[model samples]
Target chain A: MKGKTIIKRYPALLIQGGRTQKVEDWVAVEGSYELYLNDTLVDTIVVSPTDLEAHALGYLVTEGFLKPEEVTGVEQQGDQIFVRTATKKIIPRKAAHQNVIYRRREWGEIPVVSSTLEVSPALIIQCAQQIPEHSESWKKTGGIHCSVLFDQEGRVIKAAEDIGRWNTVDKIVGYALLHRIPLTKKILGCSGRQPEGMVLKAARAQIPIVVTKAAVIDRGIEVAERLGVTLIGFAREDRFTIYAHPERVRVAFSPHLR
Target chain B: MKGKTIIKRYPALLIQGGRTQKVEDWVAVEGSYELYLNDTLVDTIVVSPTDLEAHALGYLVTEGFLKPEEVTGVEQQGDQIFVRTATKKIIPRKAAHQNVIYRRREWGEIPVVSSTLEVSPALIIQCAQQIPEHSESWKKTGGIHCSVLFDQEGRVIKAAEDIGRWNTVDKIVGYALLHRIPLTKKILGCSGRQPEGMVLKAARAQIPIVVTKAAVIDRGIEVAERLGVTLIGFAREDRFTIYAHPERVRVAFSPHLR
Candidate 1:
């Protein structure tokens, strides 16, 4: 493992009607891990190595670098990780070279799958409310991105946290893949705003609903709309805005249920 | 024009000693424009279309979708832009498609350029402070990204403001290209953290110095180090962290400069 360091800070917390309290003693760790391919270095990513295997696999697949089955083995030794793949073609060495040249040879464009799940404003609010509860690391360190998987009943089945937002999502997806969970029935909830890359990753994973506490950028909304995915933004406790795929949300005003 | 709207808000100002004050009556205009290539709709980006030609050319180059010289003609029609390329082949219809398939076909690896100019910490601080003075729109709407160009004498020559950080940088670069400004002697001052994309853009422009008021990610630092570019982060008035190219910073014992 690489030399890890904890970052501590005190943040002012506001409680009901404007009462403010200062909370200190929060802790978070930061570190970097270099992923090698059969002893040859491929890429380096900044993340919590709690689920190192999942992070390696998911990052490769999402970044258009590697496929799931292409990864033959993943081994972590000290601070370095070895990712063995079946292909003999090596990824470029220099960062700029790797970005511009080898990016084409390694991966293909991700396909966007349409989602059928109807999400409601209330569900989006619930998703937002549930995000904080799932963020164990953030509550402690005030630094971390969280990804939660929720079923149709609004119950969170799995959640993961990491220093990087993409890593967090990758962990959740990796966990689902490991457990053989049906991702199509789940809603992915995040604390950060939905960017185009994040939306693309979700679409690639075939997740039906993506709910976030922050606003969705124009490009993200457009991509989600094009992919027929339901995107909910500004998902506060009592209100949310449905950017696209509004048909998935079923709103019923029945007195009997109340 | 697609329903022009001016947004006015009160932004919290972080002044000296962490004291906050509400600055009211800040105004900003929000609009979205669609870019087309050879009559085929390509993409829509949300930005102020004041410099339509520069925005179009820069977006294509930065996105790795097209080269500057590859563009045959660029025409704007009522907020809609049409870019004609020399080749008859259409790149792709969607961003995902372009990212996956067409991205690698057009561009190769970015060239790494060695820097000759040494940038100092004091100079980086001066650059950051100079960023605010050049943000004319931010003084109005408090919602624009500023890109400042500084010479060896630490004089600000070109400054551009846009809603997108990349756009702001592109505007400065476009201005430099048009005005025949020697980029090797210039430093780029930005308000946001360094991302891989931002670093790549700077490298492509061959700018020697990149100073930011925000933190730099590990990948950004690594890229800067590999490219031999001077990257200064956390640029406060009297202190800043030199991530890479530390040799560029000349420390002076004079108390007047410190």
Candidate 2:
């Protein structure tokens, strides 16, 4: 881990209560990582310095460029990761349709996840609250995003942090792929807002539930609903809002009946 | 205005206080916008579906794809904006260098903003606090980002909201360009974190100061300092942190010499 370079202190002028003071503040490092497939540049992502390998692999997978099994080898040289896949999956440059929000690889097909993984509301809130404690960079700089993957039994499979929320998800997915951990039974929790891109990452990974400590946009809910992913937002403290696929939440008791 | 579709109500299951309730919640709309320069594809950006003309023009200028003067005509057709420029400034596909973070157009030149515009710390705080009140979508959905452009005298030039921070900056810049308002003396206030990409937008537009109610990553500060832009982060309530070019912040009184 590049812990030393991840959070560096910088001189700053702080204004508080109508007064100014010079202070040194710890700031998160934002760096770029390049992904290469068979020596061809796939894309460049902005992320924290840590977990470059996981980020690269996960980005390729979650972005639907490469399936996990298609990867034959992975190598990291400096800020770039060169991966040899079974076949070169060249990412398309244009929008699948004019309405594609992100620079999508292909809007060819939307994968439907049928994981059927169920979790209680308590577990969802617990994981959402744990993001702050798990995020080391966020603790120091109050910047960067944290993403955690949990097993069906609420065990921490892996946790990752990055300057970009998408990078954090990509890191988590990459870690699972590297360790050969099955993502079908995992629940993904993020500390950033759930946009269509973020939800699509969890859906592509076949993670059943996505919990966030922030809001979810309209398209995210639409995608989550169509893809059979359980989308939960505002997941902080003792509450969370389930935007789609509420069946997998497994509410044990109904207060409405009483 | 797509006001009806901007904030849509979705049925959600709210889990709170160890119980669940069915409720309808407001969610901000996230749509994809494609920018075509002289019938050629420039890029597709994810944003809230409003002020798209400003977004298209702003995106073109801020991303260094086209300068303000180069833009001759802009027409909106559904989700796509067809732009005719004085010159076909095709954005380069490759990274200018190996270490480029975002999918930059070109890393060829770093423009140094020489605008000596200064502002009081109180005005910065006031603008930072005013973001919530000025943001209509945020007031309803809490899922959008707000940005405002202010002149050196602290007058509001434009205020915009979007699902992406970069879009907000683009909107502000586009608005300035279309209205023939110069950005050299403008202060850009955002309700999002300051990253290298965000700072570069301000620099590219010649905006002297960038303020945010969030943290400034290390790369953001580095870029801001190199490009001669004032970066103020965590500008909320009565406090703010000046990460780069603190000289632009004209603090009349300092307790340090006392």
Candidate 3:
């Protein structure tokens, strides 16, 4: 797998209080990857050097560079991702550098996710617990953020980790797109803050539910509500906080339990 | 304060085990701000709504768009930051959409920082512990990353927080640049992973020591060593690991303390 090639153990001096000792430590690989839409290089990203295929595809989709179905095949060569597409089209003007955050593609292009999945407080916590089990790179470096796409039954379908939280989410999104998985039918659980960017990714993919152990920001709640997605944060153990579109997540109602 | 203008308090469904209820939660604000230089829109960034001046100036300096001192005044209107610079000499053709990560300036432009600051293990952990005290947004939302520029004595000089780790670093660097603070003697401590990008920021400013409460990736360490920086990671209450250039840090020898 590409993972083993992306992690390395190096000697480090550890200090606890007044003591110091040398030990070998695992640190995730971080590098810059140049992505190309055919021979035309489109962008470069500094990310964990793993899951190059998903990263390239997901980046194109999230950044409004390409659609998943239009991309024929993704091939990787070291720190580059070469994307083969159905037909060559025009690339828009380099946006005003200041407004590149939003692409010209209208948010209306995103489908309203229509998944029938119900997430309980217990289920939210379950997905988080399963992350460490699947994220070997995270266990080694603790420098990576992991994203998992869980099936309708709350079972882990696919997981990807990267040094950048955005990269991790992009990888998972790419994974889902590459495999032709029904995006609306899955839940995305992550190990990074569910900020506006993360919520936007979920909304763009039409993923119905987004869960994280980290807290959600004000804009995250706004986007989740606008896009009709359920955003839950501070999901630890059996405790969680739902910020928006709670109707999408079905937890047993028992006021007496409080 | 711009912070109060951006942050919104909303009711969240808090769940503990089987109990569910609503409580008002404080969440950090996330917004996209378009930045302009002399009315020429230069770049866009998704960040916390506070510290617009630092965000704009830091971005310009870090991206090699303009030196920090060349900027005259920074004005903000909603999500847009208008940068007034001394002159509008040239605006480079926008880099290819795919390769925007790197500006025209090569990595070689970064000066090898040669600060004479010697950090101790106890000092690194001390900086990490102090971060929570200064980060109000993080205390409320836990969705923001904090970065503090510290003097050699392990005292906090200035702190900045944003939704993106890169923004926080850029802000701190901008602060140093705008005020003409000597960079070589300062240490940048952050609440994010030390990746290649983070190290590159420190190197660009010629900051000698970069410390974090998280882990440093392989390339981060590589760049730090090459740039003559001391990189510390996994810094906690009384423990820390030094990845590169240990000679820049001094810990007293006392095997008995182990």
Give the range where candidate 3 chain B is weakest over 10 consecutive residues by summed lDDT: B96-105
RMSD of each: 22.3, 22.3, 22.2
**Candidate 1, B1-258: lDDT as tens digits:** 533232323221222222222222222222345678777776654332244444454445434466445777777788787878879536555431222101111113555656678755556677888888875445543334567888987899887654345445655664565356767878988875564546656776778888887655444555676776677665667655555665566644221111
CA-lDDT, candidates in order: 0.55, 0.61, 0.59
**Every candidate's chain B TM-score:** 0.57, 0.58, 0.58
Candidate scoring better on TM-score of 1 and 2: 2
lDDT, candidate 3, A1-258, per-residue tens: 244233344333322222333444332233455667775766554443444565455445423345445777777886676877789743533431211111112355455666676655556667767766776556656765677889867899877655445545655664554356777778888887764546777776668988887766555565677777887666666556666666555444321111
Q: For every model shown, what is its TM-score relative to the native structure?
A: 0.45, 0.61, 0.60
Candidate 1 C-alpha lDDT tens digits along A1-258:
533222222121211122222223221222346767666676554332244454454344334455445767766677776767788545654221122101221113444555566655455567779998875445543334567889977889877654344444555664564356777878999876554546766766678888877555444565677775677665666655555565566544211110
Candidate 2: how large is its RMSD? 22.3
> Best TM-score goes to which candidate?
2
By DockQ: ranked, best first: 3, 2, 1
Q: Is candidate 1 or candidate 2 better by lDDT?
A: 2
Q: Write the per-residue lDDT of candidate 2 for residues B1-258, one digit (tens) a residue.
A: 333243344333332222333444333333455667787766654443444554455444423344456777777788786778777656532211111124323323755888878777677777777777786556555566778888776778778666656556655764565356877888888998776667877777778888888776655666777888888776767677666676776654331210
Over the stretch A76-145, how does candidate 2's per-residue lDDT look in tens digits? 7877767777776555422111110233233226568877677767787778778778865566566667
Off by over 4 Å in 1: A1-126, A129-146, A152-175, A191-206, A226-228, A234-240, A245-258, B1-126, B129-147, B152-171, B191-206, B235-240, B247-258
Docking class of 2: incorrect
Instruction: Itemize residue pairs with steric clashes in candidate 3.
Output: A42-B97, A42-B98, A43-B98, A43-B99, A97-B43, A97-B44, A98-B43, A98-B44
Write the number of the candidate with greater TM-score, choosing between 1 and 3: 3
Model 2 residue pairs with clashes? none
